[model samples]
Target chain A: MQLEEQTITIDGQKIPFQSGQTIMDAALAAKIYIPHLCYHPEFKPHGSCRLCTVMVNGRYESACTMPSVAGQEILNNTKELNENRRALTQMLFVEGNHICPGCPKTGNCQLQAVAYYVGMLSSHYQHFYPYRDLDPSHPDYVVDFNRCILCELCVRASRDVDKKNIFAISGRGIKAHLIINSPSGKLEDTDFAVGDKAAFVCPVGAILRKRTRYTTPIGERLYDKQSIRIVGDSQQLHAGATKYGRK
Target chain B: MIESLEGKRGVPRNRPPFPVTQGYLNKPTVVNNVETFALAARIAVYGGDGFAALGTKQSKGTKLLSISGDCLRPGIYEFPFGVSVREVLEACNAQDTQAVQISGAAGTCLSAKEFDRKIAFEDVATGGSVMIFNRQRDLLEVVRNFAHFFVHESCGFCTPCRVGTSLLKNLVEKVYTNHGTADDLKDMSYISQVLKTASHCGLGQTASNHIADTLKKFPEIYHKRLLVEANFEPAFDLDSALEDARQITGRKDEMAYL
Candidate 1:
């Protein structure tokens, strides 16, 4: 009976966590992993990825978005939640050009790890058939369009937190494209510097540091050994901040 | 306007020789919008007051709203004359909205802040309400998709609607894909304006006017990407330039995909 303890049950495990704690954060602290994307520790929580799906009291929800109310009973690690997570992951995988063999970050990628963890064997939807262009605009960084998932986490990080509305979604529906704020639609013309959150926010290998591809093997990558819940356990406070990150 | 129930199925490949030369059924036949005929009928029946009962005092009669947006409940709702947008949104349990796009696919778009404003014929057209897009929805993309619809449905009869709608689709897509220049936006604005005035039929002209209306209301949303002098770069990488080139390269050999 710690003063910080709150009465809550997650997947039938009664756990004591601090008040004002997020369900994801509390669950991760208690060793209950919730699959998630767009819930980064270094940056803000962006719930747009919708990959961290879980059920709370019989209702499906994005675990990354919902906050735990006192006396609430939450459920994660369910068959249905895992299925939906797998399906949504497969969608992002197939929607872009995710050639695992050709991708440098294949083993180390968060998106790939999520796919593997969720049991996404193959894609059910049609490949977007988009001809992605390689942006060699920055001499130190490279942007490959084929691997982007349109999560908008980078856009939010660059705009709301970073005070730069650098990213915007163009087109509609199936034909939607992401446009850089540069002349001739090239990233080189704009102030897109390396190490900016926009350049590295991609969960996939779409945007990569030019020389970092072969520097680290897939097994030693950040996403390989740890669950996203563990990495994002602290920053889950921002889950309900925006529409993208909300429950 | 010489119109017939029989002409419902097979439209003409070219202008009928008889409509202009011989005239409709050997008599001069002129075509007009059913709305005009309905108005004329209203003048005869209600003498404007009865029609006025449906709409506001200034705009008498029932008009439609093509509202397509993100609302807890979204659809065409018939309201009495002078019913404000706030009232309409309230009646539908869609109040406290994030955004509101008034008019049809081709009319003025106002956000939730503007919902307190009145809903009049001056605001919405005489046609039925078509759609309403909520804040979660994207307006630029909505109008762009609608333009594509018009482009494909065009009968290709008149230059203004057929050619003009296609041109409009191209322009709207260009603005959407971030390839449009400031000159392209100007051209887009100009083409929509001209088509609104010059298209032979209402379908070709008014059907796509939402693009113009949205641009007028939210011009910043439609600003061409490459043309804007800014320090920001998009978060996601886009390689549309190669796709555009590929399209141009294969245009001649490609079959139409409408």
Candidate 2:
């Protein structure tokens, strides 16, 4: 039996999709950008960052997890949605110590790129500045908890792709922190290698190569040349094709 | 789409794969409030029009209010929608009702001037709580209590709520203790705006409800308590440190050695 094609209207644009494709998947395939932080095309949509929330019909729903139904009206790129996105970015900044000036991933960071895309000038909320410890025990890499956004990308990559199960989130609420599953509770004690997907999956400067700091000049980095939107759109285009094993 | 059990922290899940389509072990499910179920039962017994005839166009059927504080008769009162705040106060024998906290801590704190506002979806939408405060009671104290409650109840899921509640609590206490500066007041408003728009769930989103509403409705209460004469002040006071030194030296003279 031939499958019927479906299309959804997002921000007044008609985007076509397969039967079970999510809004995010279809939008990415169409090269329509929806700013998101926790959503990596490689992993399952976590829906935790909430940066991808869009109005469906009249109700709010996260586009990352919501499936695309035929003729579904989705409102994205609106003032209300962007304003909310900017506020969420500010909250991420103030929630932890996201000091961008001295960070290694200054130009390549997804959080910073998305913040710039959403036009977040400053962290409008009060800074928590909760003291979190850093772990440099790993010979090749370091784990700086301060810059962590709790996106759980590393956690997912470590468990699913790497199959090491080295990283896990422990505690709840403000006390929640990324933990190592080893006996010593440190990355050095765990079996996490430098080449593992978890090490390279951190969207922020939290996980870094020990000696690669400032290797790429500030103005010559990934996001420094092209905006995250352009890079993300191209990346999504490739991700969409690869998902269905298409060229 | 699994329902969070009662007594657990009330953070909402992200929608899209909403409970209706994918919920509870990935099976299709329906989630409803207990009150909604009760209302459905009522509608089932009485025809839809019979229940719809009771309330305003926007808000249909009677609402159950949990009334308390400074009222002669404090208990559950069921009244149809579109009832004025003043009318509810009169029915409950509320004394000198300076303010009414409609819908618990996360709800709006309506001032005496807003008594004319009706309890409807178009006006003041409440979730059953109605706390009446007399003129003698301190509004700041009530706001402080609310701040503490949010701090204690925060689920720490996202950054905005986990640390935001504690910061809000500290700011409220700073204002309550008469150490608030003009900057503190500015920060309070800014934080409230951020929490309202950013937080992961309704709890953090409305965590600043009491502070924001009280600040707008009764500015004098907060303005009068501010001790700082300048636009800003350090987190600590040096004068308090000098007083501590004086007590340690057992010296009553003006010259305790500067």
Worst 10 residues of 2 chain B by lDDT: B1-10
lDDT of 2 by residue, B68-119 (tens): 9999999999999999999999999998889999999999999988999999
Across A1-247, the per-residue lDDT of candidate 2 in tens digits comes to: 9976789999999989887778888888888888888777778877777788888888676788888889899998998888878877887887789989888888888888989989999876556777988999899989999998888888998999999998877776677777778998788998888678787677788888888878778988778888887777222322222331122
lDDT (Cα, 0-100) at A220 in candidate 2: 88
Model 2 alpha-carbon miss at residue B66, Å: 1.8
Compose the digit string of candidate 1's lDDT tens values, residues A7-92. Answer: 56878889766655566666766767777666654454445455565656765554554666677787777676676566557656
lDDT of 1 at A99: 90
Clashes of each: 26, 2
Residue B190 lDDT (model 1): 62
Candidate 2 positional error at A240, Å = 15
* Location of the lowest summed lDDT over 10 successive residues in candidate 1 chain A: A234-243
Q: Pick the candidate with the highest TM-score.
A: 2
Predicted model with the maximum DockQ: 2
Global Cα RMSD, each model: 21.8, 5.2
lDDT of each: 0.61, 0.81
